[model samples]
Target: MKDTGSAQDAEHEVTMLKVISDLDADLNNVVKFHERVDMSLYDLLEQREWEHHPLHEIRPVAKQGLGVLHTDIKPDNIMFVNMKDQPLRVKLIDFGLAKMASQVELGMEIQPCGYRAPEICLGLPFSKAVDVWGVGCVLAFLYLAQNLFSFKCEYQMVFII
Candidate 1:
């Protein structure tokens, strides 16, 4: 029974490798794989189109248009969905911390320590720009495969930044 299981595992591994190789060969320019499927803000930035979802206009950054401040923009909050045949699409999840641009207050604690913007860290008045900062951190993490500023504490994060 042990030998049979081992053989099956080996066979599956080979099959996976072959599939990966075939995929690599098929795409001359395979986008670098990120856990979030390499989703970029380019489309959101350049197109500046907003979906009619119940959520806010969801524009890129601030002052560009009406947008919500996804205060906790992190890799874990991003998900690739609708992947069955169509090009990969991502949806920002976990809006528990989200606030409208007009609703956000000064010195309100938001965003993870590492992704927190300097203004947020310093208890200064902040706006949707903090969300942009969080997105920048997420982008850095996706590209580098690790947190751009990995720190155990907010002080360390602020110092590193």
Candidate 2:
């Protein structure tokens, strides 16, 4: 006989989807559908003028000025914090691939292909400078309104850079 567990799982997923749809439809103005703010830097840059800010705001460095590296520094990971009655601020997030400078080894995979620094792509030892390079790429993307290196593979990204 066929496995009944998968059938039950599919039924459960459908039920969950229906519940979520009902909740989405019943939400009030405070939680209206399609009202989510596009907080990502990539999206915000499309509608607003470029803001001049210090690199320290990105927080690529670790606590106490330790040499920590936010290996993945794409625009999607950066967010704009719009505070009521306060100036707009930026927050860098998604440190899932972060590592200390001393921990990174040669040829270790880190950043996304589009944002990968030259040193990392060349299989050389790297440090926080890689994060700086990533920031530069992101800044170029913001000013140009497109990705500087939109490649599917590291080889293509390095070749273009």
Candidate 3:
């Protein structure tokens, strides 16, 4: 039973990855860079009417070779499900905030509130490193079972900025 569950979980993870990959590819193809302006995920989402308005633009770079930027990669966006008796697998959900990066400009800023990188917080141009930072945070939560940065008040997250 455990073996069966494990197999299913693996299959599910693969499926989710494939979906993300496809979406990333599509986003990459549609978004392109220009001399004057960098296209952000928020712009694409807003243009496509994914939502009435763009949410906080987060990481704008494509990381892990994924074509699109997962600007919002909070723990809630990850879905963990057990397959039979196999180990749990993670599925990235909610692409509503994702964007294509070939269009980002020099002055644009994007990133989540807490998981945001120092460079972004300082209003500097960012890259895939933002996603790497978020990944690190997620890993810490998964493995260490704690937040990457701690604070008494949520607003204190700015200190790390």
Tens-digit lDDT string for candidate 2 (1-161): 99998787566545433333344222210112233333776666655665533455434312111135768788787655453432334455554466756678999988988888999888997878888788788877765667789648777787787
Model 2 clash number:
0
Which residue pairs of candidate 2 clash? none
Say which candidate scores most in lDDT. Answer: 2
Question: How are the candidates ranked when ordered by lDDT, highest leading?
Answer: 2, 1, 3
Global Cα RMSD, each model: 15.9, 11.4, 17.6
Task: Compose the digit string of candidate 3's lDDT tens values, residues 1-161.
Answer: 36987676566545445556545433332211111222333333334454322112112222234555666665555443332342233345555555556755555555566666666656678776676677666554443334556434335666644
lDDT of 1 by residue, 82-149 (tens): 34443334555444455657777888888988889999989999877887788677666544455678
What alpha-carbon RMSD in Å does predicted model 2 have with respect to the real structure?
11.4
User: Cα lDDT for residue 119, model 3?
Assistant: 65
Name the runs in model 1 displaced over 4 angstroms: 1-66
Q: After superposition, how far is residue 106 of candidate 1 from its true place, in Å?
A: 1.4
